[model samples]
Target: MAVKKPTLFAAPLANNGSKWSIGTETNVMKGLSQFHDPLINWSVESYSIDSLGESIALVVRNPSEDMAVTPRVDIYLVSADNSVKPKLLTGSFNAISDSPVFIKDGKKSVAREWDCSPESIVWSANGQTIFAVATDQGNNIIFAINATTGNCTRMTDAGSAMGLGTLGENQLLFQYTEQNKCVDIHILDIETKEMRRLTDVNSDKLRNVYIGQAEYFWFKGALGDQVHGWIIKPLQFNTEKKYPLALVVHGGPQASIQNIFTSTMWNSNIFANTGFVTVQINFHGSTGYGKNFTDSIKHQWGRYPYEDLMIELDHVLDNCSYVDKARMGWSRWVRVTAALVCHAGIFSTPGAWYGTNELWLPEHDFGGTPYDPKARSNHEEFNPERFANEFATPTLFIHGGSDYRVGVEQSLAPFTLLRRKNIPTKFVYFPDEDHHISSDVDQIKWLTEVLLWISEHTNTTLPYNLNQ
Candidate 1:
């Protein structure tokens, strides 16, 4: 079989410019425009290559402060050229070519987007047709457009793109988002368009749930009337064992925690492997849901969602026989503090120093303030302060010292209050870390420490010596 040559097209750098400029390359956004000097405003970049060695097309970015999107991209091509009197092609909204393809001198031709700023094509497969997944006006869609004619077709419907992607040949994989925060994986026949669901691996009602492998069950959003959530549980969950539970409140009050691929968990398999059930709720306020749900969470921050968490906890506890109602976040935070008080582990510190076998991976605590609003859902519902004083869970507070999202301060507030209540608690700080712990080594070590803490307090058999 003969090997085909590589298909290469002009790849434009959308945001490349001088260092001092608030340019695309720098990813700097400014509310004010003043590019008369050393590039204080104006983002810039361009494309100047062609496959034929003769320049065919050109792309450039020119930014403006008037619009939310800076530096609108402008595309052009070399219409014609001569040694002395050369030619130039320029157009916005649409570009018209002066020559034909292959038979350049035969007829006039051109291709362009119906709306210049609506979509940007960075890559394309399947001939000259460019395919992309785009979210516009609160709907997600897969669009295929002709590179030559600029005509387009929208494939895949809203909600259907939630868990969609490629797996292997003749197959496309994806998950569907359910109203009450449920996600299910499905496979579509590329040729037939016939789709089959391989697994509802994350459903609470399943027997062989793909623990930690698939997205967890979705729950009603805390931020909205009918939003959803994604929940993760332990890998080797024992129905008989009453395990510790954690509701990882992710920030991005507007961003629904999607379950596609996440390195953010920081090798969280350790959490499941260690016998703890972790819940990551998309909660209300997440995107993916329509604008109504996303915007409902705008003014109402901490309050409504915590109640949502409580309700979900009750639902899980009632359904899953193994989850101990006594074994939750508030309880965990306090229990750990009590262990320190009673000096429960004589060998805990020693075993903890033993170092971790798993590789270090960074992690983070979830949650953040929603879009600024003077009004909140009855401060009582969202006030962690009130709950913090009474929280008796064996909780370990882990946060990024530099996290601007929910801020390390959020963790500090709860930890401080819980400590005052004489609740079991430990607040560990990763000095240079941010929202999601990025350093693998730190995550592993942090997780190991958490495991040891849980083991010692829960009366499980884990290494107590830090050196173990």
Candidate 2:
């Protein structure tokens, strides 16, 4: 059987005195363009040419067989003259090269996921070093890699570096954000490794606002690995009094909740300001730790992550004496909402094939399709529907009717099951919205409902009137 691979074509243009003419075209790299392995898939994410045009840097992505595993990313130096094959400059590391901008809606702000892309690379003036950004632990770190030796050195401290740009010859400019602070422009001196803020755009807007204090902590996970998480203390927090806990589960089972101010939908400060302690665990499958840690969730979804969450919760309860263990509730993003479903095992429903738009997601995470004989056991084992009989917690189901990623049926099915089981559950559906509630009105409604749900279950008072 012959395997068809994506071909990279290049067209050179030559200006013949008066007009431009298409010269003889050719394949960019011929047979060496993509990974030849039949089992693995690969692609060229981005490419850069040196100032002299003698060398080109290419970011290649070779995804793993398991979807949970971070794709192997490498920087290859290819000579323009085609005298030699592409040389591997850097070894495989989880690269988060794309820097997404922060989104603001009224007073609420959101930082989208640190997408992996080519924008993450900044070539030094001489083209001798490549400064790239990657997620480490929970911070978006910048690393200066030697173009020749591939020796990498960490550049920035603890914060999320959103995007990078060249600043003169010695410094790199980037937008950075921390858990307590909003996004600000900062400059990094690659030589001395000194970073200073260049702009404080939100200082005035936040001068009178109260933000929660975030503290990072780690505990032994299900696999005995050090799982990381964050705990945000409520506004006007006091050690003498106990506060309700809101266990917020991040989406992307593959993504990690970093030390950055996120969107209004999942903002930890919202809960903190509402007099609730907010906790977010990175769990086993979450990225930024390492490839092994990210790959640990393969085929074992719902198992390891659930175990890690429970274990981390226990750790928090044991250490944070001011947390009211009895008054605890949890909320999750769309995909991992299954984590909550796993808690009480929802009703048996069709697997990922029925509602999920991305087929590769289940194919990669579940080991195979739902109908595959070998994968059936895994699909059944991790399916939240399999555990429907165990559900006891009061739940609120929110879904966008137009959501193509995971159909609204995913929520409706569970909501129906919970209703049948006499468990308190509410379904909040937005017909016009997509995966995320984006509009200003919807955002307000979403947060209001979420806070109301948690307050009702935990017996906490709303910090402010939602009707206003």
Candidate 3:
């Protein structure tokens, strides 16, 4: 690495075979045999290893940072010694940084990225022929890539609308999704164009479908509704007792809250099994619901999505009698009021004022008053004021340090305002996390807090690992 200005870290690659090296755009190359120094003026934002461990470095000529810029890639070779080596190709590689694939031979190149990506290249055993499989996304034709010609031909287009898998340099398998009413084992095979159905469920059935999840429910929402939700209950379910429930709102007014495993809500399981109900809602405007529903969020982002969540809340609290709403109580409401009133605390940029509230459209205030009569123009008024004077229920607000959605202010605003109002509100900030705390330690620590909340509020024993 050259003595360049401070750099923001990106994706990483490990140097295993020592056949590759790194070169900075500053013309400073690493891993040279000391035989010859090649000076080619080019810059690379980052570099990574391919599945084959070939020496492919990504070089982006000039990238724009002023706005959302598309990512591009170029591949290079390196020698065992700590310096850039012989060139393979010097032309454009069509691989979009989204799934970049640049092919190089001697001094030329052929690049490829996908358009409606369903068909993809699966590595063949010899690394000579890759699997080319396509489906509704187009086609999947497995064959060989002339590492020399940059040309490709299909081996098994089978024409069965097959799902492609690479068993080796020349082998592949295809599968598909199935339909059941509600089962645990989720198997999706787009390459094979198959669908599975979810059938029955019970406590013991938990082990079968949910992989230890005691209870799960699927809610199909209404009202511009393409919305869906998943409720993951504790592995230990007690039919006789009620439990505290949480409504985790996935942001993205345009992004769906998936039932699959993800870092954002990885800590959800801890609370669920500890006598607390963990619920995630994918509201109306969430993506994966189709284009019409997604586009609805545009221009009118906050209002419609908020309505969906409110409906979701109603769905949870209404049908589920065992839910402990008192646990949600007043303190949480107060914090929410604070967020709306003061726009929560800021992050990443500018003053201590927090981010969300600062971006609150300036047109909100009417009559030059902090408590504006116009705030509830279209929204019904349960209470005209933002933070009711004396509220109950201790509330905790968490935010990823780099979360732009809802902004750090969204969390902070509620906490700051609620605390100032003499409400019991707690705020915890994840320093290394953005939107989702990707680190395992940070996730466990977060799980601990929720566990404590559950143990204190609900009549359930805490997990042993969290006892520490």
Candidate 4:
């Protein structure tokens, strides 16, 4: 098997009627001959053999680092007997990345990343169709690929559909979630293209809760590309009245704030319920857009994403009459504090010094290590400390002492700077917690502190009594 890159080969399939056996070194066994194009630089992600062992189904991917080149993922079919070369069975599309769908208090939400690698692939009993679950737009939906024609059909609509399993020949069992709904077991009939719910366990608990309505919109962002975002209106919303804006910027930089439900601390509904119009932007570096858009943030993180957020924020303020631009406030992850400082003079983690346990992340984003002369300029250009002189917005610093990924000192530095400058700022420290506030008590305190800080800055009264 003469191939440039390391190749993965499946065990020899049982010979049904062909002369080829386990030891045969035929076209199928020869790595380059399988694709008949050695320069393709493809690797198999997953494979399945038919019951008869005559055909093998494979999921192949070609990844590249160049931002101009889009990554390719496709399904291929090849004969086990070495009788034919590999044939493409589907168009280019990401299978699924390590994107996680969170389930909390019966509600579900998704956190998407730039990597769109598939989770699992399975062939139908008859070997006529293949089923795959992938992240599309903001939802993880199911796709059915035709075995022979390379045609693809979407099986599920609206929400994060996952945990795919073969129930029978033409039926599939899976889990489903939505923006206002929780996780539920579902059954899908592939032959008839019909779906039915198997469980509604969270309906009773969520029946009386007031959940805000989410509206999605797109606008021209940096590079003239369309950027996606969401606006969640307060419950019992009045169009005639102006409301404060709670703009939430997601972490990952590579991750996206999806359209699914979340009942936990980071839920968008929390802001809406507090009489604020909540907004979220899936900026340039967010996942599910495509490889090029995701990689576009490399070496230009602070420039493009910040431009997208400000541009989209302007778009919202211009179009949404109900939003109060004067009372606008935002919260974001610790790593991307440059945006916060640049936009509002508000800053978060990693003050004057940048230190993180994840070396690969910084190296990959900045194009090289901090010590590398060619990449040092990129780091200094985006660091939040460079803009410290302009810091004026009343800021709140929160950190967990056990957070090794981004040490607590990152938050302390900025807090100290603001105090020395006599800026209105507060620090909330959790000595026992880690990167995330996991305990129920800490969760409540975290939310309270955040809401209180935002309410104070925006000069808005809390919908619920904080003293209670």
| Model 3 misplaced regions, further than 4 Å | 1-62, 68-97, 101-165, 168-222, 262-267, 325-393, 399-411, 430-435, 454-467
TM-score, one value per model: 0.52, 0.76, 0.52, 0.72
How would you order the candidates by TM-score, starting with the best? 2, 4, 3, 1
Q: Report the number of backbone clashes for model 4.
A: 1
Clashes of 3: 56
By lDDT, the best candidate is 2
Model 4 per-residue lDDT tens digits across residues 117-187? 34555667766666777776777877787656656778877677778878988899998877667788999
> Which of 2 and 4 is the better model by TM-score?
2
Candidate 3: global Cα-lDDT? Answer: 0.45
Lowest lDDT 10-mer window, candidate 2? Answer: 101-110
Q: Model 2, range 1-468, lDDT digits (tens) per residue?
A: 545655354455679899999765554544354356665555667776655545566666544423233344666666655657877656544443322211122122112232432226666777677777788878888877776666777788788887788889998999898888898899888779899998888889989788977888989999788988889999888999999888888777688888888766777888888998889889998888877888888888878998987787789889999998778876542222222312112233235466666566666777877788998887788677776677667788888888776777778777888799998888888888887778888888888877887787778878687766
Ranking by lDDT: 2, 4, 1, 3
Q: Estimate the overall C-alpha local distance difference test score of candidate 4.
A: 0.70
Question: TM-score for model 2?
Answer: 0.76
Specify the highest-TM-score model's number: 2
Question: What local lDDT score does residue 98 receive in model 1, on the 0 to 100 scale?
Answer: 26
Worst 10 residues of 3 by lDDT: 361-370
The predictions' CA RMSDs to the true structure, in order, are: 14.1, 9.3, 11.1, 10.8
